[model samples]
Target: MTLIPKSHPRAKSLLIREKLVSGFDNGLVAKEGLLAQGRGEAFDYLLGEKTNQAAKRAIKAAAAQLLQAQKPVISVNGNVAALCPKEIIRLSKQIKAKLEVNLFYTNEKRKQAIIKTLKKNGVKEILGTNSANSTKLPGIDSARRIVDKDGIFAADVVVVPLEDGDRTMALRNAGKTVITFDLNPLSRTSQTANITIVDNVTRAIELLISESKKLTKRNEKSLEKIISDFDNKKNLTENVIQIKNNLTRRARVA
Candidate 1:
């Protein structure tokens, strides 16, 4: 947590960029992740750096779904590992879930680097790089296709933060319940997820963990109700409207 001074409107955004650059230098974030951060930041800026009501509902539903899962797994990528490794670990432990690494880059070195970073953040049991004990998502032909036997492959629920489009589709097509955090409400990843939280990972992960703790004492039927009542398309549509409204307000202010 560097204390970057926020003197300008873009100050916080610049701080985010600096953090991503630092992650890259630390061998924790991929080069493309830097670009992804910038793209997400644009959306975040439009959304006024706050989580919307729809996203909050989605996070609540996500927690309930994870609680009801037989095997809940959190899908980790370089961007997610760089942004919120400790928070990811905390959410996984809070919901009694597994952590599995799934990268779009498909690099052995980057995979090891992400694993090392997660280990640095107190992750003990990581599931990646063991093809002997691996399985693939049916119809998926990407770096994310190869999941560990005991990881996403076996899990009934998966939380994919900073997810990719094709893999999210593959996971749903494989009949796995998918929850995702994508800053862009219109992304294919957001559209494909059963519950999509359209917020920054830093903010959304902590909220999700908090929500999970509160919902743990509830009954299974109640939890299933929360999951069953979620509407991803409607949620996404509302967020899109929110973003548009924000932009319209900004235009008027300017």
Candidate 2:
């Protein structure tokens, strides 16, 4: 027996359209995100759905940073809520980070629905009743909410999963350390995040939980060192070089 139904015409299409529009509005995706979802459905695939070594390291760094912060917040969007709500809640608990529901849609009913889902899964203390603050980052042209009505503005670190580049940039400009998960290495969110995990939100979150547990057993200095060592520019440069080398190797083999 099939564990999950093959398809639902209305449900599937509505889901697809929501993701496509959200991605477009957020700026990390173009029309292509929709196309990819269509293809992914054939094989049970999802966008930003894979994790790797780089992602693990980034998660570790992110965990360390959040744990070290006086105040840290985990910013959640709709896709993140659907994809890894449990993991998100787990990480927030591990690091004592506040959970904030921030979305591009900016609808109270939708936000409450997402919070209800999170609460059902045991997430506590959800914040960001207000919409996200608008930033000057490219592509994101509107305001979005920050979870900690008081703390988000003062947080030293903010973990944002599946985020848009503009908000990521804006958060960084505000002097808060930004951590994010993005599948595409070339996206602005990846480049702007202090620690960008190039992996699926689910896997990356799992690794972050593991890393937080490990770090919690260590001294604070060690944890600080780990966060300090994460250099976004260097990491991006390294990823580019690796990709080019891989392409060159493939050409040679061909």
Candidate 3:
């Protein structure tokens, strides 16, 4: 990893890039994962590189939904393992949800690398690896369709961070509630998910953990109310408006 000066305006972004580069070198991230990160960064820029109010509402709703779930599973991919492995573990522990490594660019070596990273970060019994237990998700042809029976397959609610569109829609069709962290409000993953936190996963993951802890004290009725009140379509529309407002504001300043 390169040593970036704190005084640099792009220090945090640069550091995130370095992490992905290192992850690619270390076999924790696929080459395509780097490209996906760059794409998400562009959306992040449009949102002023910060968590917006719409995302906060989504996160709160996501936490409530997870809390109310019969069995919640958090899906980890290569980029997610590379970016926020520790936070993912923290969120899983906080919400009592299971962790499953489900990769799009799936290979045994990369799968083991991600599992090893999670294990090192205090995750035990990570799923979505055993072929005998893996079941195909309907409506997707990617290797990602393979899901663990005890993990994503059996989960009532699945938290898929940095997810692809087809699988998000497939999960919903399979009668599972899908919660996702996607930066682009217009992306299919955002539009299809039951609750979408339209913020960078690296930033919103910690907030999810914190919110999960805070909401744990509330009764099931209150948690249900939080989930019931949230409208995913309306939240995503607000996020799109936020990006447009930011662009319009910048246009005026220029």
Instruction: Write down the lDDT of every candidate, Cα atoms only.
Output: 0.88, 0.68, 0.92
**All candidates' TM-scores?**
0.95, 0.75, 0.98
The prediction achieving the highest lDDT against the true structure is 3
lDDT of 2 by residue, 112-169 (tens): 7678778989975777764454223333455563344455665788887767777888
Q: Estimate, for each residue in 1-254, the C-alpha lDDT of model 3 and write its tens digit.
A: 99999999988888899999999999999989999999999999999999989999999999999989889999999898888899989888888899998988989999999999999998878998778998888889999889999999999999999999999999999999999999998999999999999998889998999999999999999998999999999999999999999999999999
Number of clashes in every candidate structure? 0, 7, 0
Model 1 clashes, total count: 0
Candidate 1 accuracy as lDDT: 0.88
lDDT string for model 1 (23-92, tens) is 7887768888888888999899888898889889999999999889899999888878877789999998
Task: Sort the predicted structures by lDDT, highest score first.
Answer: 3, 1, 2
Winner by TM-score between candidate 2 and candidate 1 = 1
RMSD per model, one decimal: 1.6, 6.5, 0.8
Q: What is the TM-score of candidate 1?
A: 0.95
Clash pairs, candidate 2, are 131-144, 131-145, 132-144, 132-145, 133-144, 133-145, 134-143
